[model samples]
Structure formats: structure tokens, C-alpha cells
Target: MSELTPLDKAEAAAKEAATDTVAVQLALAAVELAKAATAQQPAHSPACSHQHKPGRSTGEWLAIGCAVCVGGVGIAFASIAIAIGGISVAILAVVLRSLWRDYQRDVQKGR
Candidate 1:
């Protein structure tokens, strides 16, 4: 292997310094981001924090389960109602149109 010349050594040192400077700048940017993230959050006072209770009780969970079941049943019933109502409305429209045509024919015939 050939010995590195002074110029080569100087270039290598300068590259290393540049890499270190970039690393330090990235680290500083990360720290600023972390600081900004923390600053964005609202600081909760100890008293205010305690006022809001965390987690649900067994009764609350049971109530939620019942509500979900009822909601599912309601949605099923609503879907059925909408389907039947749409079919009924379509049939009614067809019947009404035919009746209207017949009435017009009778009127034209002076009946």
C-alpha cells in the first residue's frame, strides 16, 4: 500500500470534519424537533388531570356492549325497512303511471 501524502491526509481530515459537522447539525435539528413537539402539548395541571377519571367500570362496559348490540339490530331493521320501502315506492310509481295512462285513454274516448 502506498503511504498517504500530506495533501491526501489533509483532504481526508477535511472530509471527516465535514461529516462531523453534518452529524452535529442533524443532532441539533432532532433536539429542536423534540423541543417543538413537547411545546405543542398542553400542560395539564395536577388538579385538572385528577378531575377526569381514566378507564371504564364493568357496568360502563356492559352498557356499551348492550348499546352496540341494539345499534346493530337497529341498523339491520333500518336496512330492511329501506329495501322494502324502496320496492313499495317503485311498485306504486309503476301502478300510478299505468292508471294515469288508462285515465287519459278513457278521457280521450269520452268515457
Candidate 2:
């Protein structure tokens, strides 16, 4: 049988340590994300909010813009005119799109 050299053993040990470090990091991240998701009481009202990661998805901006735009339209229609069911439809589309974008980003970022 062949014996391993000191450097070879050290390399193997380092590789094992790297694996363990990655696993631990992954676990910690999952815990933090779960905590973030479940911690907040969803703000007291619409005026409250939060920030995003440094890098946000394209769809995130689209969703945010659509939500604001269509939401305004809906209110305009509700309080003023009545022929713009399209505004309600836009709101729904934006909501669904934002949800889908968030889900995709979370999955990709492994959180």
C-alpha cells in the first residue's frame, strides 16, 4: 500500500474543510432568510416599506413600476371614471409578475 505525503494529506484536509465551510454557510443563509421572511409584521400600513438587495432583477423594477402605475389608474378609475377595467387588470398582472420575479430571484440566489 502507498502512503500519502504530508502535503497531500494537508490538501485533502483543506478540501474537506472547504466543503464543511460551504455547508455551514448555506445553512446559516437559509436560517437568516427564513427569519427575515417570518419576522416582520408586514408593516403597520401602506406608508411603511423596506429596501432591496444591491442588485435587483429587471422584473423587480417592472413590477414596482407597474404596481404604482396601475394602482394609480385603479384609484383614478374608482374615484373618478368607470370605464377602465384595464387598470384593475394591470394591477393584477403586475402583482402576479412581481411575485413570480421574487420567487425566481430567491430560487436563483438560493435563499
Candidate 3:
């Protein structure tokens, strides 16, 4: 049997990591949904033991907030890029616009 190349190993590791991340995110969503459902119930409800509190420390909460902010920004940019076709096209448009402006300025300076 042939040994796996370094790139192959890295790709396999990345796939595994992505799977694990999805699983963890699903689990966290399930927990949050459960908590929200339970919170809506009466205080005397039999299932209100409060054992499912996935409370995070201040730093952890701050980290989550930062992650959410970054993710939101990324999604916004991705949506814009998709709406205008590929990101490469959008980037090229911006670069060309800048170059055009620079060329116009240089032409004016030469006159």
C-alpha cells in the first residue's frame, strides 16, 4: 500500500476537523433550543431542574461574541460578492477602478 502524502494527510485532517465542528455546532444548537423551550415553561414545571445551563465565563462569552461578529461580517461580504458574481470579478473591478483613478490623476499632473 502506498503511504499518504503530506497534502493528502492535511486534507484528511481538515475534513475530520470540519465534521467535528459541525457536530459540535449542532449539539450546541440543540442545547440552546432546549434551554429556550424550558425557559418558556412555568417555574413549577417538572422539567425545570436547570441542569442544562451551558454557562460560559466572561472571556468565553466575549470570544463567542467576537466569533459571531466576524462570522456575520464574512457572511455579509460573501453575499455581496455572490450577488456580483465571483469574488475575483469584484476584486478586479475595484483594482481597475483604482488604477483608472490613478491614471487620470497622473494625466492631469502631466498637463
Candidate with best TM-score: 1
lDDT of 3 by residue, 16-110 (tens): 89877978889999999999999997877575556787778999999999999999999999999788788688899999999999999999999
* Candidate 3 Cα errors over 4 Å, as ranges: 1-54, 86-111
The candidate maximizing lDDT is 1
What is the descending lDDT order?
1, 3, 2
- The lDDT for every candidate, in the order shown, is 0.93, 0.86, 0.91
Q: Per model, how many backbone clashes are there? A: 0, 0, 0
> How high is the lDDT of residue 6 in model 1?
95
lDDT tens digits by residue: candidate 1, 2-107: 9999999999999889877978789989999999999998787354545556899999999999999999999999999999999999999999999999999999
1 versus 2: better lDDT goes to: 1
In Å, residue 8's CA in model 3 sits off its true spot by: 99
TM-score of every candidate:
0.46, 0.25, 0.30
